[model samples]
Target: MTRTLVVIGHGMTGHRLVDTVRDLDPAGHWRVVVLAEERDPAYDRVRLSAYLEGHSRTELSLVEPDFLTDPRVDLYTARPAVHVDRKTRTVRTADGDEIGYDALVLATGSRPFVPPVPGRELRNCFVQRTLDDVDALRAAVRGGQPAVVIGGGLLGIEAAHGLRLLGMQPHIVEFAPHLMPTQLDADAARVLQRGATALGLRLHCGTAVTSVDAGPDDAVRSVTLANGTVLDTDLVVFAAGIRPRDDLAVTPDLERGERGGFLVDAYCRTADEHIWAVGECAAVLGRCHGLIAPGYRMAESVARQLTDHPAEPFDGTDTSTTLKLLGVHVATFGTMPVRDSQAVEVTFAEGTTRYAKVFLQTSTGTLLGGILAGKTGSRTELTPHVGRRPPADLEQLLLPD
Candidate 1:
């Protein structure tokens, strides 16, 4: 008899799980059901900023033309799994439909974290997350309008670029002293700052938004900073961070991580043996893996478990990133939050364009981590050497040829 597998939250990771299971269980051992809250199917959220560059919804889709039409797969669009009845092995949808399943997987991703500043709910204030978000931003933004983006992380920079592409004067406000504070060191951030400024992005580093002031119509007029300076803008985009969508994991039996993700074991299984979780919603070892690679890995691992295939335990993954923002390349990999004394730091920079830094164990020449800006070829080459002693000279590795 074929077992039924119900997957909630049909985002990128959820799609990966379905594809993996379908490929491994070719004998039709498990029938699949997917619940997607979004009207559109799974799309490449990594390239969400491309919407500003003339890319349509169809261009960014991760779903294949035939994947949804599979006989064994039942997809419900715009229907979210509102509640899970684990005792009866049933999932209740937002439309009051109850679907039964033998096994359930939660891949409910994350949502943009909007700060609780005053006037944040005003019109023209937005957060970068889904296609609807970008579309709404485009509708609100006009040519030559001033725009302010809060938080100078990856998403913040991407929002700035996207606004600039739409002909808006984009300004970035970051509480941290440097841009991409979590990924780039000060030296690399300086170079990236120069690149971003060259693209007409005005940045206000080391500043926090105290409040967003609105006009008489209750629309975003300006943003007040912690330093008593108010920036005039027509639109405000918040790209501070993300919080996991762990509402579905609130059942008494299911456990949750401290940071608001579904608590899962080594195999991405929740406390209940029949339930598993993957992606931002699931927390493994008490922390959520928000990146794509780790989430994909979890999806694959869970699929193997369901198919009775030999699978390795889902340990942690390398939190590496490589992307271009405003035409500037930025890459960071491995352990980046180490203390100065923990590893020997080697850096290379050329003017305000290129910057590179590598952390290594000086005694054994073992690579620990690295950050690269303006160039990223080294990231791909050096990633494999992480935790392993490299054959080449450390200084030569840091320098770009």
Candidate 2:
């Protein structure tokens, strides 16, 4: 007899779980049912900013037409799961429908963190997370206007770039002392700042928005900073951070992480033996990884467990990141040493256009971690060598040929 596997929230990781399960169990050992809150199917959220570049929705879609046509699979779009009855092993949807399952998976993902400030609920304030959010922003904004984006992290920078592409003057406001503070040091951020300013973006670092003031029409008129500076703008976009969607775990029996997200073991299994969680919603060993790669690994692990195959426990994940922001190349991988006592450090810089740094173990020549700013030609070659020894020409690894 085939068991019923119910998955909630069909985002990127959720889709991956369903896809992986079907591939491993071609014999139809599990009947899959997916409940997606979004009207559209899973899409490439990592490239969501491309939509601002006039890319159509279909271009971002990750699903093939025939992928969901399997007789054993059932997909319900625009349906959100509201409650989980672990006792009966059933999930209740907002539409008054309850679905029974032999096993359950939560891939609810995350939501953009909007800081609690005065007038945040006013019109024209947006959070860039989904296709609908982008569409709403594009429709509400006008060209040649000034817009303020809260946060200077990766998502905030991407939001500012998208707004600039729409012909709006974008200003970034971050509480950190420098841009990409989580990934880059102050010096590397200066290089990034130079590149961003060259593109006409305004930066306001080390400051927080105190309030978002509204105009006479109740639309956003201006935002006041904690430092007493006021930025006059009609729009405000918040990309400060993300918080996992773990509200469905209402019962105290369902443990949650200290930061947020459903608490699960290394195998992605929750406290309940029959229920598991993957993606941003699953806090494996008290930590939740916001990146897509870790979520994919979690999905694969859960798929293996359900298939009764030998599976390895998820000990940890590579937080390394490589990406282009505002036409500037940047990458950071492995463990970044904070003090001289930790590891031997090597550094190089070429004016304000290029900067590189690497940390190596003192005892062994093994690469610890590194950061690249302005140009990342060596990122592809150096990333794989993290936690291991690199080529003899360590100097050449920091510079482009």
Cα lDDT of all candidates, in order?
A: 0.87, 0.89
Best by lDDT: 2
lDDT, model 1: 0.87
Give the alpha carbon lDDT tens digit for every residue of 1-401 in model 2.
Answer: 99999999889999998998988999999999999999998998987789976799999998887677888789999999998888888888989899999999999999999999999999999999999999998887789999999999999999999889989999999999999888898878989999899999999999999999999999999999999999999999999989999887444368899999999999999889999989898899999988887898899899999988888887554567788898888888777766766589888888888888888888897898888998645676887788788777766777776
Compute the lDDT of residue 130 as modeled in candidate 1: 93
Give the CA lDDT, 0 to 100, for residue 66 in model 1: 79
